[model samples]
Structures are given as structure tokens and as C-alpha cells.
Target: MHYLDNLLLNTDSYKASHWLQYPPRTDATFFYVESRGGVYDRTLFFGLQTILKEYLGRPVTHAHVDEARDLFAAHGEPFNEAGWRRVVDRHEGRLPLRIRAVAEGSVVPTHQALVTIESTDPDAFWVPSYIETLLLRLWYPVTVATVSWHARQTLRQFLERTSDDVEAQLPFKLHDFGARGVSSAESAAIGGLSHLVNFLGTDTVAGLLAARAYYHEPMAGFSIPAAEHSTITAWGRDREVDAYRNMLRQFARPGSIVAVVSDSYDIFKAVSEHWGQTLRDEVIESGATVVIRPDSGDPADVVHQCLQRLDEAFGHVVNGKGFKVLNHVRVIQGDGIDPTSLRAILERITSAGYATDNLAFGMGGALLQRLDRDTQKFALKCSAARVDGCWIDVYKEPVTDKGKTSKRGRMTLARNAATGHYRTVPLADEAVSLDVADAPAGYEDAMVTVWENGTLLRDWTLAQVRERAAAERL
Candidate 1:
């Protein structure tokens, strides 16, 4: 068996010794994951289903146990050999854990419980925290999806304000360009797919593959024929016009779109002399929309200049919203783009009387590789534990950092039907009164059991996830 397939060895070294440290007679431990508030007010819950389907759906084998035992023994860490062997022999190597989570693609408020896990068997009390190292990595996809969702909101705002057809243009406004900018192919696949949860345009093939393989989607993203610096500059500076014309001749069919990078020599010269003057008639006569890409200089300024040049050459028509929509031309700014810069460029364009339909954005590093766990302040903490036979709340409240304090007791994510607001509430018990008039009226648990033991209880498709993400948030 491959090392990564060995669940026993796929965690922090400290986890190997945690089984010994739990209080005597501890029966089970409950843990939950949440975003403790950072960057965004809400998070688009995602990627947990992929992780569950990929890692936890398989049963462990004796070979995995033997490998883990040898590795931990040689590495000077205490191994839970007996416990693992018992799991293999008695449970057929299926992990005895129950995982509950908010539905994938739900846009949940920060600082609320998003996922909960607990051991389902008395002998597997240590299983919850043992897998923390792997499970907590959900922070990556969740953060990426949250950022992309917020970007979608920003683009939707601008499109609504400046474009006549907001719905027609909003979904393709932000395109994923982060595949090469990420750390590994796996990171690209996961982060790229997360971005696609909110937008339909992408250049990351790995993300599309991940969506298909993990989420049962045939195709999760779309891309048009586009040019890179190498493809454009390799034509030599003198033949730049030929390069531009070739892109049109090769890919620009009636009603189709093609993008060509125009900054190889001078973006202004390429737009003015080549696209605007020499090939202006061909661009118009082709009956296709030609997308001009400016890959250098200040994004807002360059985009503004490109739009100005394109408008001067091809002209524009006033949309019903009274904003200028360039004729047969558009600009895609792929450089120095993040949420802040993207909004800045849109504001600049809208202020200049240009519709959001005249522009789109392609984000790279900022979309995938730039964030960390603290970007959304994600945390997984022990909330309740079973000691002897009684369940008790467990939490940490450090005086030095009040923000790090975790929740107490077993919790459930409850949503108020009337207000569409969400809050974390303690699971109802004998001591807790949930029927009070002052309590959250019309509140119901929004979390569902997604994984139990080694079985996947619910499977979410990419199309369903996209629909949930596109729904208007209350």
C-alpha cells in the first residue's frame, strides 16, 4: 500500500501519542471546525465532500497497520497498534467516526460551526483528533471558494450598476488563471475547482478534471482560445500584426470569442496601428468578438487606455443602462489582479462611463496560492468529550488572545427562517431549554450527516453546488 493510503500514518507525529494522553475511561471526543472570522464575513462551505470521497471512503488494511506501526516505532513515537488492529479486524478497517457538515456550497457566516466530527465507537475515542491534520486542510478550498464568492458579489454589483444584461455577463466576469501559480498540481486542481464554484470561466484544466472526478460533473468550466506571451512574442516584434491576424483567422468564427495578448511590443501601438487600423475591418467582418489582453503596466490605467483605444477604433453603443458598450471588442486584464485591484479597475471603468460588460478579469496567485489558514481564521477544536460515562464541555479561553477562545459543548448550526441568519447553538439537552419564546424563533439545524463510519452518507454534484453558490444570500 502506498504511504498516503495508510490513514494511521497520515497525521501529525504527536497524534500517535494522543491515545495515551486522553483521560482514563474516556469514551468519545467531539470536535468541530469553524471560521473564527477573518477577511470575509461569510464563507462558502465546500471541498469537504471531495476530501471524504477521496480519503475516508476506503477501508484500512493490515498492511497499512503494519507500515504505520513500524514507522512510528522507528521514529520514537508511541503507536496505537492494538487500537488500529482492532479496527482492522472488527470493523473491517472502516473508521468509526461520524462527520456532520453544512451542505457543500452553502454560504455560511463566519465564526459558526461548519463541520462536526466525533468517534462513533467507545474504543475509537481518539480517532477524531487523530485525523485533524488531514481534515483541517479544508481551510484551503473553503478560503478559495469564499474569496471567489466575494469576488462574484463584487462583479455582480458592478454589472448590475453598469450593464443592461447583468445575468448574461456576470458569470464569466472572473476567470481562474491560478493553475500554474499554485504550489502543486493538486493545489491547482482544488483551488481552481473552488473558484469555479462561483464562476464558469477558467483556464485551469486540472480544476475541471477534479470537478468531474470528485463531484460527478461532465464539465465544470469553460475557456476560449487565448494567447500567452510566448505565443504572441514568438512571432518577433516586426510580425506582431501577423500574429494578431492569425489568432483571428484561426479561432474567430461567427459569434465566437478569441483573446490575443497585445503587450509584446507596445500595447497601445498594437491596439492602434494593428488592431485599430490595419485589421479593424477584418475584426469587424469576421463576425466574432475579439478580446484584447493587456498583460503589463498598471491594470486599471492600462485597461482604461485599451478600452479607450478600442472604442475610438471600433466605436460603441449606449446600452439601456446608459453605459458605453464597446463594439465587437473587450478587454481581459490578467495582471496584478486580486479582489482589491479588480474592484479598483471596475470602479475606474464605470467612472469613465464604460459598462462592466466591456471588461473581464483573470486572477492567478491571489486566487489560489496567496492565502493561508489565518486568512479566514479557520480552527478545529474539541468542543465536548465523554469522560467515564458523562459528556462534558471542553474548550480553551486564553486570556492573552480572546479571539482564540473556542466554543463549548456539543453545538449545532441553526438558521433563523424569518431572518435568514445563522448561529451556533448548543445541542438541546435536559439542561438546555430550546423552546423559550426569547430563543431563536423558527430556527432549525442546517447541518446534515455527510459521513458515517467508512460510508459516504450524502454525495453532492458540482452542478448542485454551483446552483447553491449562485443563489442570492439573505
Candidate 2:
């Protein structure tokens, strides 16, 4: 991982240590005391406790023992923190709760409750439901996924530019570079993971850590630019060739691909005069490749011209089919490239005789920080909520067929047998029963038992989570 290791959230990197200190993070020690009146009403105590446990991924640690607080039931005593902890211990990590939802990669529209949570404990029902809105606050939206889906489509345009029947995998990596730019740590990690699921990227490495332990999957890594000590000097025509040759020699290798931030001096002259010939032969002979990243200039023009330079070098670098020298120096593009910019650049590059295989686009700010016209470039919505003592699915109904419209109250989202995409419909009352085979999944089933008696049931490695999200994307 090119990014920092360990968790940005309160979670511990070491699972054992995290479990030992788990109680502090769960509600057993703190009842989210503020929202008490709103969520923990008189009739829904048990469900609230359950919801807290689920969210914390652990059991209630300060289990109250004095249960006769409601001195109405048999041997009922008001339980203290210890007593409640005992209840959690006795039940192990298995609480009678259920949650379900569309798999991570599923695209949901506005107003749709994507997941639902419920339980057998009547007093505890709405309590856990309190977190329903909060959880999806992180889950639903995938700016990168939405953008990446468009990214994949956009990339196809680049590939199609070349007349070759040769199919090429995505060369330029799409990274979840949104963490520092996100509102919260959890949101950043989960949002990054969502993109990884729908596209290939390694933004929130912690999500990868969780995914890997939860589900065995492959994780991606970024090749970071090195700079223990860095210096930049403006170059004139005289020093251009030497600067290009030196940098090219420094990073090129058999399996290594080096990207030189071109445009340091004279953008076009520097490449054609200094880089084009020597850089091309080295990459081809060394069985490696070189990429030119012009940070300052119009992306479309620079990329188009960069391709033309590579075309000029192609004739000089060829040796054999696989061993062919840098006959194809892919245009490594970045500066000021958003989805719109990406489309324009690809269109221009293809028109100039460049194959996507011979080019890669690296996007940073523009793509990572795009805004939504719906006033939500991407937002996680509460798809379903526990209302009127029962859980119901929800979705967005297009009111004016304009922007985001109606919020469907209770609905079931299912993949049409004919089409893999989801189709939203009403959730039946029969789903309340666990044994109902056709019961549509809800937020309750999606709730995985992470903790027990203030102890995590098992460890989930970030690599696991990253891997799972990656596989889900495929």
C-alpha cells in the first residue's frame, strides 16, 4: 500500500489488542446517551442494546445485572453494567438479530433504504434501528464507483480508438484517493472500499485490511513516487536532453515503469529532442516501459502530442514482437483530468492514432473531488428504516423525472432474473419471519456479529476486506 498503514479510525491494527480494549468503543460503556429520548423509547430497550452491540461489532460489555429495574417480570431486576455484561457473555456473540441488503456493488438510487435491521427483542427493536440511518450514512454512495463505472465506459472509448482487435486491460490504475478529502474516516475508508468493489483501486487501505480477513481476496497497491530529497530546476533547450536522459536512466528497468513529470522545461521540445529516442530504446531493450506525465498544460493537447512523439520513436526501438523496444511509450496523463477531461483526452488521443494499451491516464484532484448536480455527487442514503414497529424497505420514486424524486417507504429490491440489475418492489409482510425462504433480505441479516461480551468474535484483517471489495467489483 502506498498510503499509511494501521487504521485511521479508532479501530486497532492488532485484532487481539483491539478485542481486549473493545468495551470502550461499544455502547455498553456509553449509551449514546444524547439520542436516548429519540431512539431508546420506553418500549424499545432490548433492540436498542442489540443495535449498539451490532454497530460496535461486539457484545454489551457493561452488562447490567440488577434486572428488576422493571420489577414486573419474574425475578426481573434492574441490571447494572456488570449484569448487562453478563447477559452478553452468556449469549456468546449470537444475538437473535437479522440484517440483509443488496451486495456491496449494487447501485441504489436516491430515497431507497439499502439495508434493514430488526430483532426478536421487542423493547430492543427500534433501538438497533437507530443505527439504520447511521450505517448507510457510509455505505450507499460511491462517487468513484459511479465515476468508475463511467470510467470503464470512458476507457472503452480509448480502446476503441485503436483499430486493433487486441483487447487491453485497464492500464492506468484508478485509486480511491478520497480519504483526506472525505468528511470522516469511516466514510473515507468505506467509500474507498466501495470504489474498489466496482472498479480497480486502492484508496482506503484499511478497508482492504478488513475485506481480506472477512473475505479472502486480492489487494491492490500503488507505486508511490519517491522523494527523500527532491529538487526541480527550470530547463532551457540546452539542458533538456541531459535532464531527460538522466531521469529516464534512473527509473527504467525490465519490470519497472517510470513516469517522468515532463513539461519541466520546454514540454514538446524536451520530449522530442531529449526523450523520444533514448528513452524509447531503453524501455524496449530493458523490457520495461516509460511514461510521460506533463503536469502543466491542457491535458488533451499534451496527451495528443505525447502520443505523436511516441509514434516517432516507435520505428527506432523495435527489436522483436515481445522484446520490441519503447516503440509504444504509453501517454501517462494526469493534470486537470476529470471524467469530462478523460473523455475529451481519449477522444483526441484516439484520433491521433494512439491505442489505450500504449497510453495510461492518472487522475488526481478533478476525479477524486467531483461534485454532483443532484447536489450529491454521491451520497449514502437510508434506504430502509424501522417505522411503526416494523422494518420496511424503501426506494426513490421519480417524481418529476427530473433530479432525485420520491422516497419509497417500504420496498424490496431484487435482481430481475433476466437482468442482473436490481428492480425495486414492495417488501412483503411475510419477510418478518426468519423461516420464510423467499423473505427478502433486510438490514438485520447484513448485521454481522463482530463482538461478544465486549469481545470481538473474530478478527477481520484489512487485507481481507480489501480483497472482498475487489472481488465484488469484478
Candidate 3:
């Protein structure tokens, strides 16, 4: 019996996320053997599940097939299940010795292999190295978790300026709309899960599936004919109303989220003018509001202008006449968004007399890629070094501090009590002073464990990473 238990589900133990789902779906099982370039991404399920199961000390239930021998099912059709079983029988008990990473979800800078493995038993390890492509497939989640904190900050800044009414009437929404923005399926799924911890919408159904499977959280989904993409893009901007209304009616989804791209023509006019007021009314009257999307121009200016028009046209939604706003329609800023641009837009929108809560951010390119052209939010690197063998890490040196070498051996990582600064102590020789109650706020240690034993230790939900980032004030 493979009954799953949530024993290690506590905040510090397993990865805790906001859009947390109860159970992770095991749609499929894969074995990613380790190699020189990278370690096995899926090699430690046996260890992890075993450890977790033992901790629970009960009947364990989970979805997975033991593939220590041959993998007839995983190879799919044409491999012949019989042949696969034979192959598995021939290779049973053959595996290399690999060390798991120190901690999961810890930031590892560029150049240092996130997860590394070397076989104590080379013969066993040799067989697994043949599967690099498979292992990389699972790297997306780590990659997404890699940058989850930054995305959270962008949302936090926007949420800070929200007003009581706007927040009361409209909701603050963040979405995992990064499928098209990512390079591969694994990346999309993992990144999607990482973000789902805090955001509200995901355009990719696959992302939702992965979230349900891994995090077990139900996330928001996006529907097509969204503001009737075909209609709006097909016809002239002026025809947006008729097209939008027709599409909204034809594909009327109860409590549907209909986002109208306002920049099709004149952005200002699009918001101010009552285009297919009936459709807007439909959304509002139906208790759902139309979501306005601005895919062009300055998001700040557009949002400010849009809010003013909504207020003028509807007349203080709190009143009977103007108050007819249920889902009167909120603004969602798309187009180009980076951390800086996001910060700028949020600040500008707030200063322009609109509550940040009234709008949503649909961050696409910026959230997915780390590009030089766009703003650089943070740098992940192997900043210091721990000496070879029986290594001890030293951030400070008694001699030439200029060398700035890292003390390495095994390490003990802890938050400085008084100062709240992050520091690392060498594993073997424990002889330095690391405690400080007044470590000064704002300074925190950065080396985080990204991978170990070809497995991922930390599976941070979007919210946890985000909260850490917020408190760190990055």
C-alpha cells in the first residue's frame, strides 16, 4: 500500500507554499541518472520518500514504480514490457555512491554546479550517466524556485499602495503566466508551481496540472477568447466593443475572467468610452467584472487614466448609479515588465491617484528569463571558496583579508541573533565567533543549497520565497 502521508509537510521540513495543494500527483515516474555535468534530478525519491515514510512511521501511500532494475513502462511503447523487465533484472542493485546536497532552496551562485554527484561505486554510477537529457527535464522547478523571491517583491511593492475601497471591491491578483515565456515544458511547470504560491492566474493548463501534482494547490486558470483575442486582433480597435461583447456572450463563462486589451487603439479612449457597455454590464451585473488589459504604452499612465475614467463614467462605484460595479473591470498590465519597470509602474500608478490593489500584474518575459537587456535584480555566484579536502570556509582571513577566501569544511549556517546577519562556519574546526544579537538589519547570508545527490531538497512555494525576499528587503 502506497498511502501518502503529510508528516514532513511542516513549514521548515518540506517546501511550504501559499497555493499549497494537499497531495502531489505522480502522473509519471522518471529516472535521471547522474553525469559529470550535473547530478540526477530524480535519484533521491527513494531516499526522500523513505526518510519521510519512516518519519511518519505508518503505511506510506504515494505513486511511483521501483525502477532500480529495468524500466519497461517508462520507455513507453515499442520497448516491449517483457524486454524492459529483463533489462531491469540484469541491472538490479547497480548504482553509484552519490552525496545529497547540503540543503534545498538555498541560493547557489552561477558556475558552482547546483547539485553534484560522484559514484563511490563507479561501475554503478557509469550506467546512470547515460541520461543527461532526462535529468535536465526536472531542472525547471529548481530554476523557477531559483528566482521565485524576485517575482514576489515586484508584487509586494504593487500591493503596498492599495486602498481600502479598491482592495475591498477589486482583488489583488498575481499570475503564473509564464508558459510561453519559458524555454521548455519542465521549466514552465516548475516555474509555474514556484509562482503559484502567491499569484492568482496561470495561462497554462499544464502548469495547473504540475501544481496540483507537486504542491497540491488549486490555482486560477485562464480561458481563451480572452477579450476575444481573435476578434480584437482581427478587427480594428474601434470594433473592439462589438467583437468583445459578441465573444463574451458567445463564450459566456459564469464568473469568467474576461480581459480586454485596451491598447488596441487609443488606450485612453478604450477605457473612457463605453464599448459594448452591455458586455461590461454583463460582467458587473453577473457579479464578475471585466479585467482590462493594457498591452501597450506606459502601464502607469494607462492605469491612472483608466481608473479616472472608470470613476467618472461609473461615478464613485460606492453610489447606486456608479456603484453598479461588481466586476466593473480592473486593470491588468502586460507588455514588457522587469523588476525595475515593475517597481516604477507600481510607484507611478500609486502616485497617480489609483489604488495598486485595483490592478493585476501579468509579468511574462521578466519573470522567466535572466537577461542583460532587462534590469538585473540580483546576482547568484560562488563568491567565496572553501579550501580543498577537509576544507574550512573563511569569509574573513587572519592574514591578508585581501585574498577573501571562503572557509570551507562542512559548514554550520545560522542567522546571527543580535545582528540578523547570515554567516557560515567551517565544519571541522569549530573555533570562531558567530553569534551577534545586533547583527544589524538588512545584512543576510546568501549561500543557499540548490541541489544535492542529484535531488532537490528545497521546493519553496512562491509565497515562502517571496516572504523571505520581502523581509530581506531585496
Question: Which candidate has the top score in lDDT?
Answer: 1
Q: TM-score-based ranking, best first? A: 1, 2, 3
Error of 2 at 139 (Å): 4.8
How well does candidate 2 match the true structure in TM-score terms?
Answer: 0.62
Q: Estimate each model's TM-score.
A: 0.97, 0.62, 0.57
List lDDT for all candidates, in order. Answer: 0.91, 0.44, 0.43
Give lDDT: candidate 1, residue 177.
Answer: 92
- Candidate 1 segments whose C-alpha is farther than 4 A from its true place: 429-439
Least well predicted 10-residue stretch by lDDT in candidate 3: 26-35
Q: Is candidate 2 or candidate 3 better by TM-score?
A: 2
Q: Rank the candidates by lDDT, best first.
A: 1, 2, 3
